[model samples]
Each structure stands twice: as C-alpha cells, then as structure tokens.
Target chain A: MEAIIAVLLILMIAGSIYTLHARDLLSAIVSYGIVGFALVIIFLFLKAPDLAIVQLVVEIITLIIMIAVIRNSSKEDLQERTTVKVEGVHYINLRSALYLLVTGILCIGLFYYFVKSIPGLEPFGVHTTRMATTYIEQGAELTGSANLVTGILFDFRGYDTLGEATILLTAVIGILTILRIKGKKV
Target chain B: MTLFVLCFILFLVGMYGVITRRNMIKIILGLCIMEYSLNLFFVLIGYVKNGVAPIITKGTEQATFVDPLPQAMVLTVIVIGLATTAMLMAIAIRLYRKHNTFDIREINTLKG
Candidate 1:
C-alpha cells in the first residue's frame, strides 16, 4: 500500500511540474485540475472527506474560471503579438540556468523535509486519529447530522466553513465592483 | 516520499511560469498552477495506509475510512476558483482592448 501511494505521489508531482512548464495556457490549467483531483484522492487517504469534497468543488470552479480568463485574455489582441520563439533549445543563458539550478535544489530539500516522517514530531502527544474518531462518535448527536464530515465541518470547525463562504462572497463582490466601472466592459 | 518531491516539481513549474513568462495570460496561468499545487498539497495531507472506502459492507468489522473533509471542501474551492478565473478573464479582455497587443513587453499604457 505504501509503495502504491508513493508511486501515485510521484506521478502527481511529475504531472504538476509538467503542467507548470507547458507552454500552452490550456495545458497548464488542465494540469492544475489534475493536481486538484490528486489532492482529493490524497484527502481521502488522510481521513478528511469534507475537506476533499470542498477542495474538489473549488478546483472545478477554479478551472472553469481560468478557462474563461484564458479565452478572453486575447479577445482584442493579435495572436502573433506575444510569440516566444527560440526558447532554450539553443545555448542556455546563464540567468535561466542559475534559476533552474536553485529551484531544483529547493525542491529536493523540501521533499525530504516532509516525507511521512512523524518521529518525535508528536509535540501534542495526542493521537489525531482518536480526536477525529471521537468527533465522529459524537458528531451526529452534536450537529444533528449523520454524516460525520458534515458535522465536523459545520460544528466542530464551523468557523472554517464560514470563512470559506465569506471569502467567496467577498471575491464575488470585488469582481462585480471592478467590472461595473463606468465605460469599462471587463 | 517521492510524491512529496513531486509537489516541489509542480511548485517549481508554476514559479517558472510566473517569473519567466511575460504574457499576462501566461502569468494568470502560472498563478493558477500555484493555486492548484496548494489544492494538491491539501489532498495529500489526508491519505492513510491500507485504507478502504468508507462504504458500509456486510460482514465487515472495523475498516479504515479515508477522511472525506478535504474532499468536501475542495468542491467549494473549485467554485471559488471559478469566480476568480472569470474576473481574471474579464480583466484580460479589457487590457487587450486598451492595449491592442498581447506582448507584455509592449504594454506602455500601464507603465508608471
């Protein structure tokens, strides 16, 4: 099981990386969507179903939004205006080379830092699993819902959900205001 | 272990898009990439070993159930992503109308 998970993780990471570097904006969005989906799978693995559901929904919405943006980004511009021909196939520039080198080093460093090693890391010394189980055992009674995830989200950590909704409202309001500027059709 | 490394790669890709790419559309795409990496990170945070689906099965005692919280939240996040994407698209369209070109290098109207 661990081996399989490790493999999936590797695939996800690779896909995400490729998505970022892909020249096409559409491909990048698609790659990012894949990352969101993978994260949903990961959340399931982590015993956070509520978070996974929310994450998936948000990702889907975001992807759609990005597609809309990409489509309109060049609505009135010449397609040939921003061509980036002759990208690194020739002699590599020193600045670009150095940037890649530093980024590579950082990626490797972080990968090792958080790779499923929970040694003496239990500063709380309490089983997180147990707290969740306890929440599950009592969630229905406390939140009046059978779905423990819903209960946890709306009761145990209801504030987080509230914050999320508030943020969405804020974003929509801001977007509407900006679009409503006089003589502006954005 | 390697999966963690993959996150780094995804992050790096997004960063490259943001820093090296001068096109506004490309920059937005890069930002999306970065946001997506975060979503992936959140999902990975909830995985478990030898876990089975939370479905109730006959003749089953206790089974490991993957957390469903993040999954639920991701759905909402996707919606939020939609709103942001729409706003970005609108802005980009406006910029194009005003500037008449997609090249970031030639955007003199917004120069301070």
Candidate 2:
C-alpha cells in the first residue's frame, strides 16, 4: 500500500509540473485534474473512504467548471515567452532561470528542516493519536452510524460543516456577481 | 518521513508555479496544487498500519480503525477548496473578458 501511495505521489508531482509548463490551457487544466484524482486514490489507500468520495465528486465539478470557462476564452497559455531565441537556439531568459534556481534551493532546504525539526512525530503509518482514540472507540455507539467519519462530520463537527456550506453559498453568490454582464449601470 | 518530504515537494512545485508563472490560469492551478498537497499531508498523518476504514461493522467490531478526525476535516477542506477554485475561475473569466488576454503582465493598469 505504501509503495503504491509513493508511486501515486510521484505521479501527482509530475502532473502538477506538467500543468505549470503546458502550452495549451485546456491541457493544463486536465493535468490539474490528474493531481486531484490521484489524491482520491491516496485517500482510499489511507483508509479514508469518506474523503475519497468527497474529493472525487468535488474534483469532477471543478474540472467541469474550469473546462466551461476555458471553452469561451483563449486556448493558448501565452506564457511561452520565457524562452528567447538567440541565433536559432532557444535559451531560457537569465532572470527567470536565476529565480527558479534560488527558489528551488530554498524550498529543498525548507523540506530538509521540516523532516529534521520534528523528531517526535511517529513515522508514517504508525501515528499515535491524542484525541482520535475516543472518536474511534465510541463513535458508532454515540452516533448510531456505521461510519465514524460521517459521525464526526455531521454529528461531532456539525457546526463546521454548516460553516463550510455557508462558504460554498457565498462563493456561488460571489461568482454570479463577478460574472454578471455589468458591475454597475452607467 | 519520505512520504512527508514528497508531499512538501509537491507544495514547493505549486509555490514555484504561482511565483513565476505569468498566466492567470496557471497561478490558479498553482493554488489548487498547493491545496491538494496540504490535504494529502493531513490524511497521511492520520494513517495507521494494519488499520481498517473507520466504519464499524458487526463482524469487525474489534478491528483497529484509522483516525477519523482528519478524514472528516479533509472532507470539509475538499469542499472549501472547490469553492475557492470556482471563485478564482470566475474572477479569471471576468478579467479575461475585460482585458482581452490571460497574461498577467499585459493586464496591468497601474503603470503610468
């Protein structure tokens, strides 16, 4: 399971990088979907079926919306100007390459510190939960649901779910407002 | 530890895209990538070896279950991430309509 998950993570990284460099806007959006669906599989391997379901549905909707928007606009990314032609040979501009090198080094250094700074964390797949023990022990009995994740989502953390719904409502309203034909009548 | 580090690298790739990309859609895609990495990290932290899904059934009443809290939280996070992505996409469409291009450098209006 861990090996499969590691492979999927690598696939997700490759997909994200592809999205960054894709020339066609539609292909970039499709590659973005690849990262999301890869996540759904990882969630399943980790024994979080509820999250997998949610991610699957949400990813489909997001892809649909992105594709709809892309259809009505330009298909080309137009960010391909990063490369300059010098006497028939294309070279990445100096400033962009420099920025990439610096940020790459800094992020790698940060990743090193992240793993080293937290020596107390139980290694992957051997987690010791401080609060989840109660949830697992009595969740089914208290909530009368077979799924503990659902019990916590709707019963234990119902208010947070409500807030999440509210945020979605606000986003829809905001999208409608922004996409309107006119912001203010002249 | 290796899984965690790889997840962090995913995040850095997203940050790099957002910081360096010139297209509006690419920046939004970067934000989406960052969100995915963070959500995966949360789920990874909750996993347990030999643990089954957090669903309680009659036959497996005594079986160990993975942590349920992060799974629940990630459900909410996934929904919220879609909301934000939709919002950003909407804004990007409106900007494209107004400016006639998706290039951020060409959309600038503050230059004198």
- Give TM-scores for every candidate, taking all chains together and pairing residue i with residue i: 0.68, 0.92
Q: Against the true structure, whose DockQ is highest? A: 2
lDDT of 1: 0.60
C-alpha lDDT of residue B44 in model 1: 58
Interface DockQ per candidate: 0.34, 0.72
In order, candidate lDDTs are 0.60, 0.87
lDDT for each residue of candidate 1 in A130-175, tens digit (9 for 90 to 100): 4566564455567776565566667777787888888789878888
Q: What's the TM-score, to 2 decimals, of chain B in model 1?
A: 0.82
The deviation in Å at residue A185 for candidate 1 is 11
Worst 10 residues of 1 chain B by lDDT: B52-61
Candidate 1: TM-score?
0.68
Strongest candidate by TM-score: 2
**Error in Å for residue B75 of model 2:** 0.3
Query: What's model 2's overall lDDT?
Result: 0.87
Give residue A51's error in model 1 in angstroms: 6.0
Q: Per-residue lDDT for B1-112 in model 1, tens only?
A: 3454466566767776666555677667677767766666555544455554333345433666544465446545666776676677667656666665556667754653
Give the residue spans of candidate 2 off by over 4 A: A80-94, A181-186, B109-112
